[model samples]
Target: MTLLTYLVPVVALLAQVAALPATSSAIHPRAPLAGQFAGDIGACPPLPMRTTVPTSVKDLRPDDFKAVMAIGDSITAAFAAEGMKLNPVENILENRGISFTMGGDKGAVTVANMLKRFSPKIVGASTGDRIVSLCSGRLCGIGGYFPQDRFNAALSGAKVENLDRELNYLIKTVKEDKTINYQKDWKFMSILIGANDMCDVCDGTNLDGDTYERLIRAAFEKVRINLPNTVINVMTIFKVSEIWPLTKNELQCKIKRALGLKALCGCAFVDGDTASGVAKRKVMDDYAAIWNQRLLKVVTEYRGKYDNFAVILDPAGGNTPLTQFDPSFVSNIDCFHPSERAHKYMARNLWNNLFLDSTNKAQKWPKDLDNTIYCPTATDRIQVA
Candidate 1:
């Protein structure tokens, strides 16, 4: 059976699973404590109060951010992230509460939680379980189903083309929230898109380098025009082609493939080390490089162009090989999507990246996942310049 044909049943199964009532079997696993990474690391001792909050995006400190927002695909929605070792059906739910970028569930080591240590009043981090079926266009909520989605407008199965819709939703939602000062509050927005586009390269999606660049640049332009006092972290797309050989041997991954249910990135999961497979892998790698290059170019063009707007390129997953992590870093459900462990590691890396200039940010996964969270001092500002 073709991979596309297998995806048909998988979609139907996901819908059925979404309707099933919650049970003990469906309970998500608890995320690791943020403090476990180091000894009794509580919230940062309050930094000496700022003399006056900075008005420009380039000068704002981490604590100055008043809101957190995100846009991407399943990874940001955190599909199947919490129930990695649980029943496959149960793993289909969106675990937004612990997503690396915008999740706000207590005890979960997420960027939102990490930021809360600094700016306790910041709004927009997603919380609780979000029904995967309800995740769609602006119909989901003004700013996504509140508490469950908050300002995280990301949708599962989204591509670069869908970013405009997500950005519109985010803009409307933030404007609607009464607590936020839309024109004045410092906002931190994280974006990790293009993975879905890269996944469809071999699927005849026709998303070549130029097309990718145009679509992504258009999305950033919208952000620059609409969202003032915003600092955007434009993360580079992952080298997903490298994941196939590392995961092909896993039993659950094997069964999912046999049933044609492993459709997240069909281009990356091609079988065997034969000439055809090697050729396809190389093509995916080339496309990934092109996509990331275009993304960097888009960010570079936005630099220093506006005083209240800054876009920083975060090279977290861009260069890291899948082999750098243990097998547990990926979900056991479909052997795709990052597990909660991976999210914790990502939270730390992202937090540390905020303190350093873009040029000095670590390009590889930290050798020590534990104790990697960087504590900001009196002098640290969220780096965008």
Candidate 2:
């Protein structure tokens, strides 16, 4: 009797879904997400805030920012596949009609590094360089992606201070190009750093929460003063603890070590399953939490003061969090830096936060988008405006 009762409801649910009309354009609307990367952009999420950085979604110019810049460690660096040859990743994006071009040496994972990941189809690159000369490795992917992405200004082994160093390089080049007036035109910036401070304890420079937050705060403040009208989006540094559990036991980590490879951030070295590794992992996770908390607090302050800054609280930041990503999100080579698709997710969140508000003001599409997200695709492909 119990099995039959359970089966009855399950069978009915399947039948109902099967009976639904086949139409991608007929999605039922739901409340917008809080600027996340989980769903299709067509499923409009809420905006970050009124004080966000983009001009307006309706400002659908093919090229949006005066310059779209990224900064960080290996996560942001561009490496050549052949260490001097043409990067297939860059070529693929260009071939897809995405308006992006590499300037510096090629990147290992071109799709994940720069502005091209999940940006609006109308996005553009400034006279800014494509790859930051500092990076030197394959880093990480993209599918179900929209064109018009951000550019890679990130360098390898970049700590918070390294970004402080690279700021001048990025700004000077863009300004020298004379593509847009620095004071008037908007520049897009993505800041994701601090992993080394937490995980790479090998450096032995264990900064307290105060010192770490100070460096981060100083970086943001400097950007505001240096780049007028710049839109700064800060992603909460990813949780190192989450990473340890994912790859520590997986065969990929072992293979990476066997091949004499190192993760961009060395996350594999901190195995939480073991006793000693767990201790270190706990401390690093603590550091990550403290940094994320400080980031949000600082962002709240900056948002009020600058009127062009916003913070995207990473779902991966805190304990037992809601935004759970699988190991595939990280690269297989080193398993530390995000995979290409992960970059797409990152871009999706940033894009959602930047444009969701404007999208809300626009028309709904696929009348039942959120509702039928799990529905079969063959039946629906219409775009409702």
Candidate 3:
């Protein structure tokens, strides 16, 4: 029988496991994620605020930066919308071509294949180029994900578990190719995966919350091994139920649940077993919560982990008024994939979150140490009003 065929029963079993909701499952509610913008941009637990870096590559004066490279699935591909020549390859790679390689699917990716494709020629590249990376670039996926910011290799369908193979690939590549050292030139890496793991299974569908945690942990271990000193930033997945109706799938059921529709009363997006029914809706919330908790553990474990390596979470930084955006401009065209507009928003948000004001209000790059101190209490909120 085919793997999916063989796993049908297994998926059912997993769903049963997560379906058992607690009599009083109290979701730990925290403060609304504080952003410089207006609206319900959720926030994660407070991280020790680091002084923002005034100058990012995007802030580079005319002569300062060139060439940027992105590696991953469709999202990255979409980010490369203007074609390879206009892609970040110019800012980060300085004209050197990037080797394109990846294994992608609508709902999942495998670590094994990802490892097979990680070659120095692509990621490690030659010595002259810089790396500007993003991954789990696309959305709607199943398994095999590794979260790290060593290079922009984040891809959709990349689960937290797949980090081991990805890191191993990087380690092997660097070892074999003496000229490419991520430690010396690793500029920035972005982590935007995990939504798929959670979103893959929908209501009354299969599930496995426990294995998912293990996978995330495994990926963390691998990340530490490969890109120890790079600046790592993690972006939280968004609540998609509000946009469910916009999706092509019959997500009305999921939307109803999210909106407290009849059968979904009191159902937190991540409630397991009982949640099995709305597998699609719960995946993003559950996977993120699981990944976040474990990620915190990994962060603690890797404290002072890598030289200059740090983790920052940007939850709810997505363009707000998503419902109000011009349908033509709002991507995620397949209801699953991000359109060019979405990718542009993601790239800009990521760029601003890690280096500039989180509000995305700073009109210009900070000029000096003095300018760095100008971070305001909050910038103009991102309200559609």
Candidate 4:
């Protein structure tokens, strides 16, 4: 028999295996915890006192922001965020509406949705879909082509290297947006990137600590010079190397890896416990730590330098180890991306971080999926003085 004849039956068997449906309970857990909010804008309490408009960025409150923008990679893009559904294509769709940081989908517990509760006039939060085409590349689709992207300049597979493009797009979009008064309107921007860089460490990518710092500082400087009256929340990159042990044993994850479906992060997913694997993982961990330190340093340099621009370092995933989180928080599709439930959790975490002092922000991931959303008081400012 010809080799092609034998491969046809093997391919068919693999297709059948991939087609088998995953259990909803195992793949898409949705049971809310006791403290979880009902994903309602009405659930949020009103400010404790009368609203006083602030004239300075230092005095800006949550309600002061008139527009929102975000720049990052697939996490901000909300790639396959709905979890593993029946259709594999649907699994790869960018559910921008439900993204943890920038999604403005109605009834979704996202950072933008929570911000809306404070200021209904806030605009630019992304809504609807940005379908991704399957390709050999890590990220798919054009950046900012879809109207659904709105102020979310984030693109799939975006790294610190792509920050310049995303930033330029954001500046141009905000300038062209008729609803926004570019010079006067207070803008809130969130940035979460560098996972791809860390992931590519094993692949011989030249994204070391110094390069990461330089790229991030340049992005910040650009925003400082171009975007005024903006508060940038710079979230530290989490440790991707720590996630492998949690989901490595899952049958579906293993199957997907075998089929080459979940091969994005070589440092995290490739090579098990072999000597080379251990060495690569060590390198990844070291780079993650250095990158986070660089992020903090950049924030420190920019702090108090610009009156109209402020960069806050949000220690959400970076402060705590990923091993502390439940494995179920990961997406069922690739076993690396955050699930929708995790997105909600992240939204709460990011929202709460805005109200907290840098030193006081929650470091560890919430044990319960339904963690309490922090409500800001009249005295609370988004950027604490």
Candidate 5:
């Protein structure tokens, strides 16, 4: 059989997931926050949501931030940039002609980037101003391709194993600085981690589900203790497996995979066209599904405990086995990372979810694209040195 022959079972599996009727429960446009996720291999539910600003729905300008921070790998870094592109790019919603940091060049288009919408002077380490780090600090999510830095121990390319330490470091440093006064200033945090953990399993690194849960719990519990009143928005890991399936149609990606330019190639497929490789790929996809549910479970459990956390399901939608991403959602530079458009999509939807509580389609995050607020194209954005 040709290499393409393996797609049949995958297609069948998806039909089963989609054709099944939608089950009823208290469907909020948000996460359960209390009970289990009702997720099965073929019945994963919507991701969760929680946004506790402690600021009484008041307008939050960038200067209003006592501090905003993040923890994760490159995906999280997309918003927190250093001049080096690998530093951290957690998102500062600014409309300056250029985004002067690592992940920008495209823009600080993270969920936090949505702050730019409300008019805030978001600042960070690179700003060289006394109020810089006081406004925001993306202390984690440095860049390096998946599997390459999946399990690194350095502060350079942080992973799940490293998040708690990073949080501790951020807390210590923020505490030492007299500039931050927690009573009047609010803290916001975003954690888009675990893609590397999923990549680890895809690339032969160990990922124990129970251990992963423990790590997640440990990180959040630490955050709750150190930054007790912080409002945290946790984005769910993208379906890394979906990238592979959609990616198969792209000739350049296929050629790169055959020529050894892509690491995710191993993640989507195995050594050859043999049945074993196909089976392995299926397992990998199942792993993503299981873990996505696990993430929902973890967040819900913690929300019941902390009340400050929320999960951003692939707010772009089309993430389930039955659904897929629009090609424009991923970066053209590498089909792996989210595109600038995708980032704006998250910023828009996440903002809406936090701002609204209804599940109605109109009330859900606005699915419509608004390029007027910020340009979504890569070429349209000006790159700053």
Candidate 6:
């Protein structure tokens, strides 16, 4: 009858509520409208074979050699300077992957401008000049672009309606740019786009998830036509829910409460809608998840279409249990931008999946240690201009 006894019962009830199962269509009418994603989540067909997650593949060597280019938005632009540390080149393919920018913006981004920037790099022909070319034959490049690339050409405020325009612009750019011989020089292409489309449209009056699949398919088709000989690598999106949890959204709360009542079950507990105190750190992680899945679909489809093309999953494997690594060793922090360590990780992951080479496990890579010996104190976070 004491406080301890009363609290025990309450805690037990909450735990039981959390464990309940959930059943519903992936997208509801109140959710965002994905032109093609509007089918019954249960009845919708499994994603095409091309969408399979990437597994270990050959290491790309320095000799796999050819021209290359990179394209996308702020996330892609962040690759320069300290941003490179976010995902290291060594972690990508083994040898320090040679990479240089084609073009990118910090805010909004789209595929049209990406094609324009990327064209110059591929035709710049030289052996080491080939940037991060994974496959060899002609020029090859990888674009870990933000999802907005799939839709709007302007990259300002993207939407599903803009997808066709973006694709056509890429095609037209390749056809018109005389300096770069798209047919003669281009050999391989890697695409990582579409996260923003979902992030922007996830809530509101239209709640269909079917359109996501359709738009992706159409984009791939455009790639097939525009770059015929190129081997395309597609990477599936990693789990962002770990970084950006779903239950945190106001819209999600309504769904949880409704489901709990409609199904005669405690959906709030199971869906985590009632957890009043989610940490700030946890919320940031969940936000990352929301954006992750959007681009992953694009990567999967590209890989599934062609044999020479490859698929990579979780470029930053979540199992590592570390978010931001030390800038000096594994990371280079430019504000929120990745440190050198992080870039190295990205480079190695790319190398492992496409290139055939020994793992660069013996490099001067930093340990996952946060020991006081190497760890910085309060002084590190301070800045003076």
Best by lDDT: 4
Which stretches of model 4 miss by more than 4 angstroms?
A: 1-41, 48-52, 133-144
Which residues of candidate 1, in runs, are more than 4 Å off?
1-43, 84-89, 133-147
The reply for model 3, stretches above 4 Å from the true place, is 1-74, 77-156, 174-179, 203-214, 247-290, 293-306, 317-326, 329-333, 356-385
lDDT of 4 at 66: 89
lDDT of 4 by residue, 1-385 (tens): 1111222332343444501121122111232121223334456676543455577778877778889999888889888677766654465578899999899888787888888887888899999876752211333334335887889888777778888878888999999999989888889999998877777787777587788889999998888778888899989888888778778888988887676644567777778777877888889888888899989888988777767888998876886667766767788766787888888878877776676666666665555566666556666777543
Off by over 4 Å in 6: 1-71, 79-169, 177-180, 194-208, 238-335, 356-385
Clash count of each predicted structure: 0, 24, 51, 0, 11, 64
In order, the Cα lDDT scores of the candidates are 0.72, 0.43, 0.33, 0.73, 0.42, 0.30
Of candidate 2, the 10-residue stretch with the lowest lDDT total is 376-385
Using alpha carbons, what is the TM-score of model 6?
0.40
Candidates ranked, most accurate by lDDT first: 4, 1, 2, 5, 3, 6
Model 3 lDDT tens row, 1-385 = 1112222332332233201111221111221323233111111122232344323322221111111222333333232222223232331121111121121221112111122122112242212122322233232233432332223343333444434434554455444445445544333334554433444444432236566556655655554455543444445544443344343233533433333322221222334235453554554455555555565554455444444344444544332433443333223112334433344334333433333323433322221211111111222111110
Q: lDDT, candidate 6, residue 374? A: 11
Question: Which ranges in model 2 have alpha carbons more than 4 Å from their true place?
Answer: 1-64, 78-151, 258-272, 307-324, 356-385
The residue pairs found clashing in candidate 1 are none
The better-scoring model by TM-score among 2 and 3 is 2
Which of candidates 1 and 5 is the stronger one according to TM-score? 1
- Which lDDT tens digits does candidate 2 get at residues 14-114? 23221123234322234243222223323333222223334532232113344566566545442221111133223111111111122222221121223
TM, every model: 0.86, 0.60, 0.46, 0.86, 0.59, 0.40
lDDT (Cα) of model 3: 0.33
**What shift in Å separates residue 74 of candidate 1 from its native position after superposition?**
0.3
Tell me the RMSD of model 1 versus the true structure. 7.3
Q: Per-residue lDDT for 78-130 in model 6, tens only?
A: 22223222233321211111121222222111121122222323332111111
What is the TM-score (0 to 1) of candidate 2? 0.60
